[model samples]
Target chain A: MIKNPFLRTFSLGVKSLLLHKLRSGLTTLGMLFGVASVVAMLAIGEGASKEAQDQIKQLGSNNIILRSVKPLEESNSNQSTRVSVYGLTDGDFARIVDTYPWAEDVVPVRILQQEVRFGERSLNPRVLATTAKYQSVTGRPMLEGRFLTESDEETVSNVCVLDYEIARYLFPFRSPINERIKIGADYFLVVGVMLPRVPIGEANQAAPGEEVTGEVILPASTGRKWFGDMQVKIRAGSRDMEQVDLHEIIVGVDSSENVPAAAAAAREMLDRTHRERDYEIVVPLELLLREQATKRIFKIVLASIAGISLLVGGIGIMNVMLATVTERTREIGVRRALGAKKRHIVMQFLVETIVLSVGGGVLGIALGLTIPEVVAAYTDMQPVVTPAAPILAFAISVGTGLLFGMYPAWRAANMDPVEALRHE
Target chain B: MAEEKSKAMNVSLEATAKAAADTRAVAEFRNVSRIYRMGDNEVHALDDVSCRFNAGDYWAIMGSSGSGKSTMLNLLGCIDRPTNGEYYVSGTAVSTLNDDDLSELRGRHIGFIFQSFNLIPQLNVLENILVPRFYLEDPGIGLVERARDIAERVGLGSRTDHRPRELSGGQQQRVAIARALINDPSLLLADEATGNLDTQTTEEILELFDELHSDGMTILLVTHEEEVGKRAEQVMRLKDGAIESVAYNRPTIQR
Candidate 1:
């Protein structure tokens, strides 16, 4: 032939694939789903990890937090203990703020979890008591109205701020701002609403054993006077009861860069005041790093599981291709008898495989792209899809097709003309 | 005396001219043998088969079912190589040629027509006829004109675009004949080309073959029917893979 025979034969192979469109399409479906799942799963995992990391980073990568530790022995043994202990008191906060010049800002907080009643509606809400600087230091934004001012803290005014979910739940239809809500027995006036925040860390707890909920914020001075040290009693029986104190303090550093130094300064100040080792420190930055490493391993394991499906898909392609070779034996023989070379026959089958693989790959990419969006819409867990995942999946599918298609093409090329011709 | 000598010279010149015309033999087989091994048994398909067929000659090879008529045809068409001695087609020693070289030779000089009229089912009549020309080194010749001419000669001009399945048995056979003649080959080898046709169709095909033979085209036909053998200028009968008899047509008979 004057022209390249390989090109002509390759075209013939493609033409043959086109002739059996249904068979080719069915064969490629396995590869398509295999690739799409691999890409979508990996992307979702990566996206989840990224979201967690960002939340941890926002908590201040350099910060170390120390919370109150009131031992159960002290509370149970004596109700009226002479020495007040376990948590950082107003004196300890004053000492830390005064002694350490490196300490940029020390925000001492007292937290209470209780049912606050507004009209006929009642919902359990976390109550935070801190200074005016607390909101800016921890990156909490006031959604509406104004935050607690220095005047409010100094005067111990009965002013409160509600979190977004709490406001929505308590009011339902009306605005909760400037409204009075009874906490235990005293009524406090609402000033502002806090924006919504997604919970992080173990058991969806913002802290250990604490069920995160929409919260109400009040001035520390006002909380101490009105709530009177904030104690809750869990009744074991009619006669026996256990009392717990609401003296937990969440200290906010001025900046993430100063968090570690500020935390160390506060610990040193608290150590001088308290003799017993009855406190715990938690660093979100450390937790974030460890979680990231675990996520990396998680994504790899998930991708491997998806890879098994692709391998199965490849085997499916091979099985179908072998069957096709047997089916087209007479056709092969006729071409051979008519002077077609072995390479021509081989090229023809290989082209068919490529067409199937590439077509499946394109469909798979489209499917993979929409998977994350569909998942996000239907479920609470949002899946993130990355471009690299789809590209890798497509390349791997094509490679698998080539690897599996070789054997059948070789078998077709090696068929004996006489025997093939005689095959019915 | 001079006038008598001139008459003698004219006669001798005419005889020499006839010899020169007969000397253009397109194929020759010299002591050719083909052996087929079936387990421990060896069957001789063609034992010392020797023959010479010239251009423009119409010859028939007659044999029974187990005889070596198909084997001889295969050897002449270069589809199978001979086991012993030499076989030449158009002055080329085919027994000495490799597979690729033999294919090239076959494509260039021989055209084959089987009893089944083996046309590719997917291809139309015109495409089927153009198959052999694709193997040529330079297919610069006007293929369209060549296909049209051959189609016209075989009375398949109108059915050039029709697939083999769409045409009748006689029409399919006509397409096959047109395909065989497309390359203007040195020799045409037909193995019972009209065996599947009706008597009327067979007569029509035989008449076409006769006309082609008269117009300076050589043909070698293999058939078991005596009536088919009778239409050729020369007939060779085979028995037990050996030549049994050879007959020539009478002077008044035209093939």
Candidate 2:
């Protein structure tokens, strides 16, 4: 009877929703929670992934690390097998710096596990011997005293930097800076302490015969003079053991763009220099990329799981709407008898569903916004909330409502007036 | 009294005598038959029925439960179509009209009152009376004022705002009557308008129908009761979907 069919149908929809407030509310709850969970899960996953990526990126995406790998034959050989030798030396680092134009900075490291004693305080720790340039290359910041200087390396000074955890463990009562510590009868002064860094692999554990309590950093020149190609002893049996000479080196490139080329260049040079393949180059940047790819896939899977709930919510809406159609059969008959057209009936139901879904969507958005904060407070997992997430969630919810509402609305519109009137 | 009686007899004879007079017909049925098919069976609701009624006339169709009285009322109300043959209202062949045209014709020319006083339960008495006006193109009459006028004329002025559920059987039927007359249609079709009411309520409805006929409104009333049929100016009895008898009443002169 009315010319403005949209407005009329919309008003009728509002009235219908009002008629069954509880049913509408319950139906809306399903959609609300569905959308909220989808947004919240994605936000949390994104936050964790972003934090990891930032840490990796801070590790300098351009850096390439090379570590020694002892051959299986060397391990199985007799204890008297004259100290098996492997991995990069001063020659490999010199060659990469000289040959590759892309090589901007190079920092080589040698590691030794030794028992250090200061009075009754005796502890074994991972002692890294590296150049002063290592500090700038790895972006490692010093918390106290000073980092290794070029003068210290030149003079072969016995200056050392302690990891924060090691300093606290070694000198619990006093700051370890400027304190003298002994490493296998050699005295070294602790110059500075480094802040804590996230452990690379599994939770902090030591390699065999390696110390776990603290880390000791020293100049590479001083390390070469004292340890002089330190040997690692591996025992196969009670009496059968072998000593191996190997070194772990981390080479920093100019930028992330040059990392792949640097790695390739280093691999080519190493392949030619070593008669036997006894070295492995580990690229933390490549691992970081792989991890990022995995996280992206993880996010998609998490989002899909959350999307299932939204689908369920839509089905819930359809179910309730169908029930409503049956419940209001008499009302539809009355309206039809009063001159309402088929389209009017269809629009009335459609608008009712839209109102329910939109109301739920708005509430879901509010709920989704608080999810990050809620997760941070109640759980160890961090949640990241982005504007796009909630917006997409709302859109998805509304779309779901519209898609699911059609069948029931069509059923209502096509109802026979005579049969509907006689429906009990 | 004698003069009045003689004048009434003269008027009655003149009306019967002038049945074949050349006047424009308001409703006509020519060999109209209605057959209802139920599965493999067929039942003739109205068989080869032919009838005509002039403008400004009051007629009653009387019959038993299965006598097709209600079918005739439905046909006159345009709520149904004849199975075969032609039925005309206001000189328009109704059987040939499409659904839209039929509905328009019903809105403009025919109004109906049902046996059960079929008022929408949620609507007020006034709203019930204005239901037909919703279908009108212009509604010609101011809905509120017309509703109020009809309510008052039917002795329901005080109850215009009351819902159908709140009204008594006779009050509801009166509202239905008011609704049927709201459009000022050419023909008023009532199907047992007072069927659900008590004797007093039936008398009130019949008195209202009498007043409506006196006001020059043509009326077709379907009823099973002889008393109800006898009250109208003409009576046609239907039996087994065929006309059984026709009778004319004694009409009173205007003066």
Candidate 3:
């Protein structure tokens, strides 16, 4: 019924708080830091998860990757042997593509960990030997020249497509497009350069130590003719030999919904044909779903930690308000004598606390948004700020104000007017 | 035809008003007793005390410490209720009202001037004067105008925007007086109002009170100063929670 009572009360509260500038400012810091931490933490978490999901998307949601894993028993026993016959065979790739009706395309890859040389520069890169369909299946972009063609595979051409990083490393002085690179005893022509496949830190490989820094692509028929099917690496004094027709097979489906069935059929066929468990399946769609679930839980954990700080900030407000109530006892008494009801006194104190928290909340949101930009500037992290982060933080700050201001407001309202007037 | 009927209604309304004016006092206490309990003992702060304050009358309640003078002022102001018996302000029984309704009654009918002036420290002279109206439903238009008028009347017209701390003891008491009159209260209750002021300022404040009394305001003041008491038209002295004697300083004018 009063004329602009809320506005009047709010202004009155602000006036009183302004009387003690330092105290009000210090109290505001508590909520400011609390809300800032919440928003900044969530933004950073969302950015990291987005980076991971983007990498998974690059792997093609409808594709299933089957990687050969050397069994522990075979690896331990084959250290002294001249040759170890284990892992995915050429027959397994043929069986999956021929029997599974859902499999749209199958590209078999053979990885030869070898060092390539151009003049004095040398670097060990994973050489991927696959068909022309490998480029279409993996969805990697071609930077320069043309990718491997079916004619190159049939003619068994001694040519390779270098990863962009590998190309830059080898031919820092000039273009390596038409240059010849030495792998072993033979020299291969550099036909093309493709974009670096999922930078190491961003890509989540299924097994540890499986991240490939740089790759050199060659046609499957040409690789078989030149490098043969056996790979030997000398470590310390022992030579470890592995003989496998294929290292990995990427199975593609028409849509993501068909990936699970294709993967299941492929797994079953491989299990029946291979005696030992030497292969693991990686599904991009399943990984994406799991990553989303993990991100949600991670956000909750971050919010809760931030909520605790807010609770402490709320307690700080309560503590200061209680002291203020006691300090303003005579003022309360005067208002009561002047005909103010209990609720009027409550509204006065409640308004003061809300102003404190909401003011802090606004400032906190500003600071929260700035933290992400500063992080992105200083580090290689892509911190994404969603529209909801600041809004959520601000709502919580207001809630904290109301929740914590109740008891002190009630105390101020219920004071005995006579005793309060007599209070020093 | 409507004008004639309304005139008849006004005539009857005046008759009822005159009849009610003859019997009712501004404030009355009927055998009011206020007791405070401490441990096993009962302290009768005001035991069976009865008194009446009429319109345009200035009465001073004189007593020693623990003589229940302050308690009597509080009860008459409607800030405290009696332990027994009844109190009436503007002819409405205080005992029948709830806390919120009691506050409303106090706001509309009683004006309190405390010993320390009790002007809110943070509020300016005009703000303090307008404080009572803040709690009023529909405080009405021209509230600031009326508050400024009261401030001018109290000789604070130029200092309306100055806070209480910036004012002298006499000026602070004047602000309190202006605040009390903001709502046009029927009864003014002062508890040692000039006790904190110097002799010169107290004289000035008491002159203001005399002017208010001459303007037909009912005033009750509790004080131990005989000089303060001598200025009132009637003086009532209390001894051990009961009235020992009441003396009249001036003859009542026939109404």
In the predicted model 1, the residue pairs found to clash are none
Residue A3 lDDT in model 2? 30
Q: What is the TM-score of chain A in candidate 2?
A: 0.79
- Against the reference, the lDDT scores of all candidates come to 0.74, 0.77, 0.86
Cα lDDT tens digits, model 3, B93-207, are 6766778888888788888899998887767788889888888765778888898899888777689889889988999999999999999999998999999999999999999
In angstroms, how far off is B189's CA in candidate 3?
1.9
DockQ score of each predicted structure, in the order shown: 0.11, 0.10, 0.40
Give lDDT: candidate 1, residue A212. Answer: 38
Give the higher-TM-score candidate: 1 or 3.
3
Off by over 4 Å in 1: A1-110, A114-122, A129-162, A170-212, A217-313, A353-397, A422-424, B1-112, B118-154, B157-163, B175-192, B204-255
Q: Which candidate do you rate higher for DockQ, 2 or 3?
A: 3
Tell me each candidate's RMSD, in Å, in order: 10.6, 10.3, 6.8
Q: For each candidate, what is chain B's TM-score? A: 0.88, 0.87, 0.89
TM-score of 3: 0.84
- Among the numbered candidates, top DockQ falls to 3
Per-prediction interface RMSD? 3.6, 4.6, 2.5
